[model samples]
Target: MEFQQTGELEEDVWFDDVDPMLLEPSNNLKQRKLSVALVDEEGTDGLTKHVAVDCEMVGVGYKGQESILARVSIVNEFGKCVYDKYVKPREKVTDYRTDVSGIKAHHIQSEAVLRKLLALAMRDIQGQMPISRTFQYLKKEIYFSMTFKEFKDAYEPCKKQVEGIFLLGPLMDKVTDFRRWEEFQDVQREVADIFKDRIIVGHALSNDLKVLFLGHPRRKVRDTSDYKPFRRLNKGSKPSLKKLAQVILNKTIQAGQHDSIEDACVAMKLYMLNRKEWERSNKSKGVLKQTKYFCTNDSKSIKDEKRRKIKIFKIRNLQKKRR
Candidate 1:
C-alpha cells in the first residue's frame, strides 16, 4: 500500500479516463462533436501526463430534471488548460439553468459543433499518453506515501470510528455544489490544496469525491450520510445524515442534497467529540469480570473478539512465566 515516488506499486493503480454516461447519444450530441487538444507552448514537449476534467449541464424541472451536458473543461498534469468546449443539448436552456451554468443556446451554435470539439479534445488528450502511462503519471503527480487503495484501506477503520460525529446537510446552490460534479476539472488540485494532510469529513463523501473527480492517495473522506461507518460500517439500513444527527449528535442538520463542506465540518466535529473516548479507552482492559482485551467496537464478530482475547491472554501468560 505504501506508494513510493517512482515504483511498481505506484504504476499498478487504475482510474477511469472519462465517464461514459456523459457521452450518451442524444439528438443534440449526434449533430456535432466538441473537443480540444494541448499543444507544446515552448520547445519542451508539453505533453502533460495527467488530466482532470469536469462538465456542466442544463437541467429541467425544479430539482434538476433531464440534465443535459453543456460544458466541459480539462487540465493537464502541469495545471495547464489542455481542453475546453461547450456542448449543446437537445432541449432549450431553461432560465434557472442559465443562472446556474451561465450557458445559453447562443453560447453553442449547434450540438454538432460541440460533439466534434469534444471528440477532438478527447483524441488529443488520449493521444498524449497510453492508459498505463497515464496511471503511472497520476500516481507520481497526484499522491504521495501510499497508493489510493492502500491509503483508503488503512483509513477505513479510523473513518468508521468517527462516523457518529460527522454531519450531513442539504446541498447548496453555491459555486461548489455537487451538481457541478461533472464540471470540476481542478478537483484534485483544489482539494489537495485545501485539505492537504487533513482528513475530509462528509456524509457519503465517496460519492461526492467520485462525482467531483477528486481522488486522494488515501480515501481521507468521511461520510455520515449513510448508516455504515462513514457510510460503510453500519451494515444496516441506510441512514440519512439528518436522522444520524438526531440520533447521534441529537440535532437537526440537513434535508436534501447533502453539502460536502458542511458535511465535512460536521464529520470532523463528531470525530473530535468521540475521539476522546477512544483515546482514553483504546488501550483500557475490560473492567469487573470482562474478559475482552480490546474495545467491543474494535472488532466486528464475537469469534474475532475471542481470537483477540486469546492472543492477549497468551502475551500476559508469557509475561507471567518470565517473571
Candidate 2:
C-alpha cells in the first residue's frame, strides 16, 4: 500500500509501531539517548553491544533485476527500531517492487521533485548564495505556494530551468515536502557508524554489507544464514530468513512485503536465543584466528601453496606409475 503524503517528517509517520525506547527527544539527541535507552530496556542490559540490521531493495538497473538499497533499519537488543531511513537511490528506480520491498512510487517521487526544485532554485541564485539560503527560501517561500502553477508563477525567473529539468505534466500532482530525505552515501556512513564496535546480527548480511559498501569484521558478524544449526535444518544449505524464522523461531514473517524492522528483530531474537551455543561453537572452532587469517593476504598464499603441493603429489604418482 502507498504511504500517504502527510507533509510531516517521513520517519514520524512511516514507523508508527517503533518502540518508545527507540524514540529520542529529537534527532540531535539521538546518540546520547541511545546509550541510556539501550541499557534501560528490559532484558537488554548487557546486550547493548549487539545490534541487528536489515536492508530493503528496489530494482534499479536492467529490467529491475539489479537491487539497490532503498531502505535500511537497525534494531537494538530488545528488538526496538533504533534507526530507519528510506534512501534515495543513486540511479533512477526502475521498479519499486512494492509487493516485495514495500516501497511505493510516492516514497521516491518526493525526493525527485525536491531535487528538481532545488536545481531550479540554485540556477535562480546563480551560485552567489549559499545552498542553505536557497533551501530556506524554498522551505519558507516557494513551498507555501498551494499549487504547481502557483509555484511556477512565483518563481518565473526559473521557468526555463523547470522546463528543462522536469516534465510539468507528470509532477503536477506530486508536490510534497522534500525536507525529509537521505542520500545513499549519507545513509551508508550512518549505518557504518551505528555498526562500529558492535556485533551485527542479520540473515544473509553479506549482501546488505556489500550494497552499503561497508564491511564488518567476520568475527563480529552473526549471520543466521551462516549459523550451523539453521543450515542443518535446511540439509546444510543456506536457508532463507523467512524459512529460518518460521522453523526456528516458530514465527511467520515476510508474509507480504519484507519489513526491515521485522526482519532485523527476528535476526536479533534468533541470535539471542542461541547465543550461548553459538558462541561456544565459534570459540571451539577458533573462529577469531581463522577469520583473521582468511581476511588477510596470508589466506590467498596458503591456498596457492596447497594447490602447488597437490599438483606435485599428482605428478609424483604419475611418474611412479610410468616406471
lDDT of 1 by residue, 222-247 (tens): 33443123222122335665555554
TM-score of 1: 0.30
What TM-score goes with each of the models? 0.30, 0.59
Instruction: Tell me the tens digit of each residue's lDDT in model 2 across 1-323.
Output: 14577767665444465433333222221112111222224554333689998999898655787677888989888888889888877766778788898876445556555566555655667567764564456655334425545554544444344455633433334345344458887998888888888889998987787567676788888898887667665655678988867656667789998999889988888788788888998898887555441133244434554575577579789999999
| Model 1 misplaced stretches (Cα beyond 4 Å) | 1-183, 225-235, 255-261, 276-323
Q: After superposition, how far is residue 236 of candidate 1 from its true place, in Å?
A: 2.0
Misplaced by over 4 Å in model 2 are 1-47, 111-179, 290-323
Tell me the alpha-carbon RMSD of every candidate. Answer: 29.8, 19.2
**How far out, in Å, is residue 28 in model 2?**
44
**In model 2, which residue pairs have backbone atoms overlapping below 3 Å?**
none
lDDT of 2: 0.68
* Model 1 superposed RMSD (Cα): 29.8
